[model samples]
Target: MIMKAIQKYSVVLLLLFIAVSIAGCGNQKEESSAYSIFYINKDITKIVKQPYEPVADITDTNAMIDEFLGQLKTDPEDVEYKRVIPKDVTVLDYSVEGELLTLYFDKHYSSVEPVEEALVRAAIVRTMVQIDGVECLTFYVGDAPLSDQSGNPIGVMTNDSFIENPGEQINSIQTATLVLYFADEEGSGLIQETQEVHYSSNISMEKLVMEHLLEGPKSEHAKSAIPEGTKLMSVSVLEGVCYVSLDESFLNQDYNVEEPVVIYSIVNSLSEISTISKVQISVNGDTSGVYRDSFALDKIYERNLDYVDAEVQGNVIEEGATEELE
Candidate 1:
């Protein structure tokens, strides 16, 4: 009787051991699947949480654009900005048909001069492209790639939609960030651009010297030039050359010195940005014009320019205020 009981008990223990081994194997498989970082969730709604991180959309298109528009309506007394973005009144209808993000708008922008149109497009595209889940963008205004800001023919809902993949199902609530460059043709207010422009992608010894050592409040030469919040007008790059044109006040206000130092300071600062390449100076937005050519304004910089030495006319700070430090 005792031997028979022992045999049955041994069988039961063996079965229990096998069950435990299988359960351990199953857990290992689950752990391995969770280890991958690039898992594309078919249902993003199930995975994406409030305040998405890592793979979050770069710009909160809905919020930022609204704030940008609100800034325009601000009273003149409430602001001190140089150029407000001109509000464009073109159609801004956007929708997603599969992977292609279609933008429908009117041709109201082309009337605002080609250069203005180009600048506006660049700005909008850059901002939208910064968003996640956006790839190819198509523009259609009426029958063409130009139209009004809010009208489209295909669907009843004329607003935009964000598509996860370039050619996938359109996810509702995802506002199709319109890759618009310009506003309505008759947009009268400040014109806001949306482009990102860059100069030569190089670094050299001379470029290094002029670049870093030239900018900032403390320069070896010009003491009080280029005030804070000065708007950069234009930066032209040609064959490793960087010609920067800023507000005229950058030069006129920051100086009480001879021509050579002023020229040297500006040239060194910009040339340093590029690798020892030449730097050119222009007033307002022209290197050569009636104001430039007749007087040889470039040459006048070699003689009559005056720059104030920063060491002598340093900022007068009230004692114990710590304002400058702050």
Candidate 2:
């Protein structure tokens, strides 16, 4: 969500302003007095942090933000580290609401390569949220907010958003093969597809599964079982049951897909994981209510092949049972 726009200032003024405000925190002679300025390695493969000391102190919140952005756009003294912000990209405007800072950039920001863009984002977010009162940040291109390639909103990100090792390793890559379920062309039956994925090891397997599920199906005849614009808030597994928490948008089901189809689509896909035997879905973590007419958000669901089309099962479903299953 965007707020009122704030005027931009020169880098020097921003740095000076931040120095004065931060100096108020305590003694400037302390050895521990420094904040980490995140930068991309020269290879653009990972993000690294450099120590930065404030000269004075910062009293203004906007100045602190400007200072961090200025540091991000400026190249570090070490040639090994590169500036996170590309020359083509510029922060056109910005806004602040509570602890959330929203940066509105020019259209050029969208042109960044996906891999480098993620690194750049990690650097920016890791640096900005360091401000005393700012806890999270989000991005906007012109009037539109940023969305992942899958079209889900990136939403608010904090230090916990990016996985970083204790010392340096950040945004490390890992691979996994997933068996995901999607809706058929009719949007009334479940179809299973096996997919190989290369992702950040920083992300958990369950979260990765949900991300791919939200991205929709890659098969020609398959369709997405989940609702468009549904945001996965959180997901985890405990005692063989995977608990999937999503935003309220999940409640806005598309009419083309049946309720049970949508429900089992998640249930079966998550159950594909060896550790997950059952699945429980909740809206914003509140399972007190039901989904639609008969499906309960609090209910624990087990994989049911009954909804799988008989064509793929080769007569596993008894004749004329498809209608009954739906």
lDDT of 2 by residue, 52-168 (tens): 865467758898888888888897899998999999999998898777689999999989877678788888977876677676677898888776664555655666556555643
Candidate closest to the true structure, highest lDDT: 2
Candidate 2 lDDT trough over 10 residues, lowest sum? 14-23
Residue 257 alpha-carbon offset, candidate 1, angstroms:
2.6
TM-score of each: 0.28, 0.63
Q: Candidate 2: misplaced stretches above 4 Å?
A: 1-33, 149-152, 164-173, 182-195, 200-204, 215-223, 227-256, 267-291, 294-326
- Residue 91 error, candidate 1, Å: 5.7
Scored by lDDT, model 1 comes in at 0.31
Off by over 4 Å in 1: 1-215, 218-222, 226-230, 250-255, 274-276, 289-326
- Candidate 2 versus truth, CA RMSD in Å, comes to 11.8
Computed on alpha carbons, the lDDT of every model, listed in order, comes to 0.31, 0.73
